[model samples]
Target: MGLKAFIGKLYAGIAQKQIENMRKNGIGLQNKTFQYLVNEATATVFGIDHGFANIKTYEDFKARVPIRDYEELRPYIDRIMRGDDDVLWPGQPAYLAKTSGTTSGVKYIPISKQSMPEHITAARNALLNYAYETGNTSALDGKMIFLQGSPEMHEVSNIPVGRLSGIVAHHVPIYLQGNRMPTYKTNCIEDWEEKVEAIVDETIKQDMRLISGIPPWCQMYFDRLSAKTGGKKIKDIFPNFKLFVYGGVNYEPYRARIEESIGFAIDTIETYPASEGFIAFQNSQKDKSLLLLVDAGMFYEFIPAEEFFNDKPTRISLKDVELNKNYALILNTSAGLWGYNLGDTIKFVSKNPYKILVTGRIKHYISAFGEHVIGEEVEHALMKIAAEEGLDVVEFTVAPQVNAPAGQLPYHEWFIEFGKAPADLKAFSQKVDKVLQIKNIYYADLIEGNILQPLIVKVLKKNAFVDYMRAEGKLGGQNKVPRLSNDRKIADQLTEYILN
Candidate 1:
């Protein structure tokens, strides 16, 4: 919060303003603003440096400084370690948000008061902008709840990586010096065993409404709320809770259970927040997935899956982005990431510059046994099969344990917990296997020859994943379920006890 940092943030705000101005240009960028943006882009392209301070043209930036990844800034992190202004951006960053990438590995994303507004701005655009344009803010009246990570800033860890919890912690309304809860903060449970109890306790204490967070966690919470309140349904406890905002992972399968638990189909809003950026959120009631917050504080770029590997990889600017096209998201935020691959793919559903859809995870792709599968495909198949079985399913995760040779079973261990188990297991398994085959062609071939084994649904004990996360110190706050696995390893380890 020093003057130098203030100046840095001032510059960032100005830079952010210039970028947003480009969006209003419509079809394409106007020449003046475009040139100005390119100039700003060149100087802060990889963060401000006196070494390249004089550079003024986009072509000069391209010719001199090539596109780089997060690792290339090792020297910058070293400078940050010394409290020097070697890192990108103008200010000295204050805190780091410890967050994990799509991969299990973790990184501490750099955050400063200046750069934090990007999150605030994106969130405002998500709510205020939509409300102003469409008169939808009225839905958020009464107590608003955000199912985000705890605001306890970790004292250690200097590596700067972006994650949702830290970002959520950074921007949430704070009226207290202690824990970071929403305005109507009450006695919340920090204990794993007592976490759901605490949520139930708080819900009953206040006229609670307006819920937000990942689907699995939110669903589990209200289910516990319904149970603890004796007969008070979630609809009653949260009568004013008009919108149930969800993000963090693919939510198709869990939506039905959430609606069922609440005993009513409440408003469901979707968002996509990551360590890299608050990529997109539900603008209108019509949900196609992530609607890109184009007017955010960053330069947006997209590279298709096929061209993502070229030496001189090509990218599509915001104005040039095509509809119905799937491309990897690359972000250049004021916090200092330039040309950074966010490890997620988005399909542009409409030409609305501010709206787009999250198709799938670029890193969540599981091909452990040559059966290429994405989260959505697996999710749809499971939902369909579960529907056929007539069971209320809570949460499920898929992991491929083995690489099968042709005609051998490629084990797909599914951990599923249901409100009520289906009367018949054989029929349920057959339906699940068929769902797999119809969804993924490679898996279908694998199943036909027994390369991938018949589906196995291990009905978990209720609130099992929640208990596990609480045990890991990751429950209640901004923690997320292990959505899709890169391999079968984590899914196996987490569910090993209950599976047997």
Candidate 2:
């Protein structure tokens, strides 16, 4: 075997063994991991203050450290940024990953030496797991283009502040860097447009075997490639392109357009990697579920989504999680975040193997007028309808339009940017409304009681969200249009670009 293929097989074997060990040990290993983390962090100020040394049980840890969001953890992160040692982790973080925040603006997430390797390892294992499942070692032979964020790192109190992708890109193994496309200089181009064009120019003639990126950005890359290569599909340009690895957004809506761009079906792997930590990855080619990274240096807890908004919610461990129940994720990582609510929700598909599907973000929902709707419900409805109608939906967002003036009632408004529109717009709106009503009883009750009007659908000009995101300085890399809003904020903004 070639060097790349040999390395691929070796890594795959290692990854598969780790996955199997995780599955077999599962809860016992998780508890031990938690105890280890607690012991390691006991010397830190935050840990010592919380009595981490005396906390031998999960219950004691939970009682000592209350669940918190990024806002609550910001002060400790700020202390770390100011070169404080052992404020949260055992020492100062190596970098501060700047993630987008809602009202708080930029959120600086700490990345210590302990946690950075975990991120890198998780990313590597994702590919290795894919190789193990598919037995396609040839993927490592050709170039793998990771359409990622700008590598321009800014100094935040002597620590780096930049996108997670860029941070990880710098840490890409020297061996794999040989087969990775778009040189570091090209990736450092801060302007996404310039980066995309430069990447196309640099790698158009190379042998590309794998493409890994967020679906929206990947679509843009594929579109540019197709356009540049005389209307040829991605496969036509790079016939050996065998794998598409994606995360950051639901791939369902983008799947039709992605396949069209590729001109054929290909293998895919999904991942649930966040700046907080790399959480899960699709391990089996046969199942669409993702195996939870139980051994990945992070302790996990789940709060039932139904009770998440309550004054006191039940928090359960990985062993206590049930199949097919929506739960908000809470994480305690070696990176110094204790009981940090990642703000994302997920449901377990298989407990034995510990597979999960990301449901939605905690605050990403529309509950205005008591017609509660989550991102997962809206995405599923839209994906199903778009498939049935043979339409290609690129992106979409929903918000409540509460002030209907004097006599009219409030209704949900959907702003969609479609690659291909439905034949009947009115019928499309009706179908979407029906699905939401069926999924959410509160919404159905409102409609039946004549308290709310039927949902409204407005097709926006193509790239409307792209334009909005650009104006907001959030054009690429992990920044996505919020799927649902409680108010008319996003809807009103999109109305400016609506096609009528």
Candidate 3:
């Protein structure tokens, strides 16, 4: 191994010890994190208002702070944006992570100096853990590309503000700077298509071994590269490519098409990161679920997904969580977000090491006919059937077709963009419907009761989803189409791209 690789291995060994300690003492670490955050922010405006000074227990904290989403927390954030001192964190925020919100037009999440290192360290540790377990560090020697938002930042009240990925770009460890690709000039281009074209031109000849990005954007890059090379496989173009790091959305639905683009299967590392904080990462290749970061300067709370909207939903710490039960994730971070409803639902696959799988979004689900189906169920069903039928799906979404033609029953409409169309569309649809039924019993009951018909498959033209996202002004960089929706907002817009 090279000197850099040897150093990386040694660092990985040290990180492994820390990880083992975290696994062994997750509960105690979480409690300490809670106390640290509470004590650190006790003098802040939010903390003072919430009585953090006298709060001595989790229940006290819970009773003092109400769970809030971005809209509800915006008042405190606005104060900080106006240059107020000790409003959220101890002082002013180090940076603001700008992200698109559903109801709120734009959200600016704080990232304190104290909390920012956790994000960087968790991501670094994820990679180091991979090297430690697999004994592979060859990718570090080759060009590594992280397809992300622009690194350019503008300041608000003298505080740097930019996309989470963009902010992270400015902090890339100096050691890896030599290996990172896609010149700063190319990265700074605002238009995604132009940026991608520039990236293709810049990296096509480089020895790319580690590529990281959201799956859809990466797929676009692969497609662009294929077009440029006259249909060359990704592996053929970058023969040394070894690991793909992806987050922001579930990769299962895009797995087949992505592998086909690459010409073979490759190792992958999945991470769970957000504007609020870095939550978890896949520490082991054998375990698909992410290892929750208990010591990452954030305290976690869970509310049963089914009871999330209740006036008094049961909120429990990690110690009280049960296996396989879906919970809406809540966060109280060193960044000074208190009782923040993260809006994502997760299921604990293992409690010993605190491993979790992000099941879906709390607000993103299909229940038009009283059959609530989530993102995981839909993705699981489609991925299962696609594998069995040897089909390759590029992208897909599920929505209720509540208003069917006069004689037709209301049904679930599956808008699918297929890389490889199935031999029998009807059989494919039936198989997916069956699997979905098995996954969500409520849907099965609805179908059995004749309340809803079997799902209808609508094959979309090539690049349909890409076109839709572009039209919606959400082309790339952490933007993704919802997998399931109870209403027809997305379905209505998608009609324009439906195959005739």
Candidate 4:
């Protein structure tokens, strides 16, 4: 191994030991984290207002603070933006992670000095754990590319503000700076297509062994590279390419096309990260679920997903979670967010070490007919059929079609973009519908009761989703198309791209 690889291996060893300790003491560490956050923020305006000083246990904390989304917390966030010190967190925030919100338009999530390092550490340890488990650190010696938002930032009350991925770009460890690709100038381009073109120009000939990005954007990069190289596979361009690290969405739907572009299969690590906090990461290659980051300066809570919208939902801690049940994730972070609803749903796959699978978004689902189909269930059903039929799905979405033509029953409409269309499209649709029914019993009952028809598959012309996102001005950088929607807002717009 090279000097850099050897150093990485040593660091991985130390990180692995720390992770083992965390696994063994998951519940204890979470309790400690909870106490530390509550105690540290006692003097802050939000803390004082919520009676944080009197909170001695989880129940006490819950009673003192009610669950809040970004909109509800905006009043406190406004104070911070207006130059208030010790408002939400201790003193002023080091940075504000700017992100798009569905209902709120834009959100500025604070990243405190004490909390920022946890994000970087959790990301670093994910790779370190991968290296330690696989005994492969050679990727550290090669060029790496992280396709992310522009690192440019404006100031709000003297705090640097930018997208979470862009803010993270500024913190790439000094040691890895030399190995990072696509010069800073290329990364700052505002237009995603133009930025991707510049990236291709800069790194097409370089040795790119580690590539990281959301799966859809990464697929676009692969397509651009192939065009630049006259249809050459990604492995042909970067022969040393080995590890792909990704998050933000499920990768299974895009797996076939990505591997085909790469010319072969490669090791991948999945991470569950967000602007609020780094939540989990895949610790072992053999395990598909991610190990929850219980000790990473954040305390977690969960509400049963079915009861999430109730007037008074049951909120439980890590010790109370059971395997295979979906729950809406909540957190109290060192970043000064208390009783914050993350809006993501997750299911515990392994409780011994507290591993989880991100199931879906709380607001992103289809239940127009009382058949609540989630992102995980749709992805699972689609990918299963795609694998069996040797089909390549580029992108897809599901929405309820409440109104149909005369004498037709209401049904789920699937908008699918295929890299390679199936030989028998009708048969393929039936197979997917059968699988989905098996996965979601509610959908099956709706069909068997004659309340709905088997799903209708609508083929989408190539680049349909890409075009839809572009039209909506959300083409790249952490933005993703929702897998399922209950209404026809998105479905109505998608009609223009449907194949005749």
Candidate 5:
């Protein structure tokens, strides 16, 4: 066998062992995992203060610790930043994964030394499981390129800070360094445009067998590659490319553009990693859902999305979650976050092996008129419309047009920047409205009751969304266009940028 094939077989074996262990334990292992976390964390300040030593059951643990978001944990993180050990976990985190915030400027999530191995292992298993399940391991033959944030780490109160992607890149196995592209020097360039140019120069001619990145940025890279090489598609440049691993945002809308650029069908794997920790990843080529990383150094809980904003919410363990219900994910990780709300919504597609689909962000939606619409629903509707109309959507956002001058009703406004505009723009807008109406009963009722006008569609000037993100300081690397907003905050901003 070739070296790549040998490596693929090795990875398959490792992933199989992990999968078998989970299958052997089943739901019973969740309780054991929770117990193990509690025991390991009992010595920390959070654990002691939360009465972790006395907790014996999931119910007991839930009753002691309340569900919290980053704001609630900021004080503890601040203490950790000041060089305090055992504030949240056993010792200080190896680094803080700095993430862009919606309203807040930034968020610093701790990445503990105790938890780094778990993070690394979860990533490895994702690739290996895909190889084993599909028997398509040629991806291991050549270099795998990842488009990530700059690796230049900054310091916050004497603690290192950088993007999660950069932190993970630092931990890439030594054996695989020869097979990963874009040298560390190139990865450290702070300017995104410069870095993209550098990456194109560094890997354009390499045997790039695998490519992984968020879909929108990946689209940007493909565009640059095609432009520089004078190629019709990415396949013309890198014929050996086999897999496209993506996450952080919905890929449905970008799928057509990416495939067209590739000039052929290639396998795709979706992952659900966040600043808090890696959560889940695609484990089978046949399945659309992701298997939860149950064995990783994290304990999971779910709060029904409906009750999430209530005065008091219900938290359900993995065994209690029902299929098809939207739930806000809660995590108590080895990295020291406990009962933390990651703010993303998810729905389970399978319960046997516990596979889930990310629905949307809990804070991202349009609910100004009691006609609630989440990101997932919006993306799905747009994807359907684009497919039928042969359009290529580059980026888009939706907001409630709440303030009408006079003699008009409120409605939802869609701002879209298309790579390929439709032949009949009016018909495309009508189809988009129709699909959304079918998907959301609340929205349909609002239209039926004459409480909302037919949705307004605004075909944005080219690069409008990109310009907006650039002005907002969130131009690249896991930052995404806010899919749905309750108010016209983002829509107004995009309007201003387009005018400029």
Candidate 6:
């Protein structure tokens, strides 16, 4: 009937067969899925061997195809670098999904009409799976605001071209096609700016609830709804609104701010949103990975952080992925990708098949001398400081730069933007540094060698991340700011323009 019913039925149908496949193969369920995917991946690239065809058999793929990062995807990047339809796989790449990654300067990801369904299905199934778990399927009543990239519609064709928003723009035509979607689909127009504005307008009028997108965009949507309707809080704008779904970026300060702004402790759900795929999600209970969409789309991989990019990356099969272990996330998607390292570190919050926590980005790590620093480490450090300082951090970024003098270990430099800064800010910084140093003996050794020093706090002014993003045009409506930077190039530029 609805999206959920259709997906639920689909999920149920495959689940039983999946169990049987696992039993027959004498392998774990997760591996069974991956094995099946290997079969498909080998098929997708079986005969072809160029940007037009990178497909090789599973064994050949394993031997010939090295695991590639965003930078390694350069050839494919170059093919569609110009957004030439001819370069993409035998179809129109609905829009080029833009993301500012580690190495490759501003690159556009080719998201096709076919790829769109996988993303949509994985995301939709995640929500329904959550609903089944929480017994709150009806909680989706009222308006559901999506805080995605602004629909940057092409003026001539009346479609969208915004890099990040392309993720949704392609779907607009399909969902809104005559009888395919509910009447609500027509609420979206053919204008870039109006896409977000129209969604806002509907929530105010239709009592919207269930907002989804990155944390920053959600806050913007609320700000727009509040400023326009004279209602400062999300509840004030949509009184019937019940749930707020967030992902794409971490939700620390926004969580506190939104909770305070909303009259009641509103429903807040977090998800793992990526351009290549929607990999994992969190539900209302916040018990970590809710339910993984194992059947519908992609085959995943997990390599240990210690060896993710090494000559021989230490890896564990999905079947071997344990609960609460940080592993580099890799995937082979139905959209024609094999052994793709998505460049994010995730932990198995559960092992009942498909579920994980988005710990941090694989590339965004701070190795204080030797103790490898990951996003989770920084998140822990900041959350601890926030709790101690009684501050609600809206957004923050960390940069492990060559900030120290020529020979000293580089400092764990943090640029913090908080809802409240304490009088004893120095104490806060000291505490954070102390925690990190103790947590990793590498920090202690580095401190002994003056290789690593204490955590330095750069208290940013308001809307610091936003200003930095704006300076970089990273704020073009539906984009996000990097949560962590290894160098001061992007980070300092952002801090100078915004936080300074």
Task: Encode model 5's per-residue lDDT on 1-500: one tens digit a residue.
Answer: 56876887887888889877875665766777788889988989898999999999988998899988888888888898888888898877889998887765688899888788877888888888888887778877788998998777988767788999998998998878889988999988877778888899998989898899999889888888999998768887888888999998888888888898899877999998887888889888788899887887788999999889998888889888999999999999888899999989999998778889999989998889888799888898888988877789888899988886598898888888888988777788788888999999999999889999878778888878767878877777888887888887788887754422
lDDT (tens digit, per residue) of candidate 1 on 322-348: 886668787766566655677777777
Worst 10 residues of 3 by lDDT: 1-10
Off by over 4 Å in 4: none
Regions of model 2 farther than 4 Å from truth: none
Predictions ranked by TM-score, top down?
A: 4, 3, 2, 5, 6, 1
Predicted candidate 6 versus true structure: per-residue lDDT over 1-500, tens digit per residue: 45644544555455445433433442344445555544443323221443213433334445555687766766665655444333324434565566676667765555556667767655665556555555554434333545444344442122234545444544643432332211345334434245556666655666554666667666666667777877677676667667677776667646766676666787667766577766656643656454555554566767887777689876555667678778888776645455678877877765544567777888787663555767776777778767766787877778776757776656767777777876787888888877766666776677777666677788888877767776665563446556666667766675563444
Q: Global CA lDDT of candidate 6, please? A: 0.61
The per-model lDDT (C-alpha) reads 0.61, 0.88, 0.93, 0.93, 0.85, 0.61
What TM-score against the true fold does each predicted structure earn?
0.79, 0.97, 0.99, 0.99, 0.96, 0.79
TM-score of 1: 0.79
Q: Name the regions of candidate 1 deviating beyond 4 angstroms.
A: 1-75, 102-104, 112-114, 129-141, 154-196, 306-314, 319-322, 403-408, 448-455, 498-500
- Against the true structure, candidate 6 reaches a TM-score of 0.79
Candidate 3: lDDT of 282? 98
Each model's number of backbone clashes? Answer: 18, 0, 0, 0, 0, 12
RMSD of 6: 5.3
- Compared with the true structure, the alpha-carbon lDDT of candidate 4 equals 0.93
lDDT of 5 at 380: 86
Candidate 3 residue-wise lDDT, 320-416, digit = tens: 9999999999999989899999989999999889999999999999988778899999999999988988888999898999999999899999999
Task: Decide which is better by TM-score, 4 or 6.
Answer: 4
lDDT tens digits, residue span 1-500, model 4? 88889999999999998899888999999999999999999999998898988999999998989999999999999999999999888999999999998668899999999889999999999999999999999899999999999999999989999999999999999999999977999899989999999999999999899999999999999999999999999999999999999999999999999999999988999999999999999999998899999988899999999999999999999999999999999989989988899999999998779899999999999998889999999999999999998999999999999988889999999999999988998999899999999999999999999999999999999899999999999998999998998898998999999998
Model 4 scores worst on lDDT over the 10 consecutive residues at 99-108
- Quote the lDDT for 315 in model 6: 54
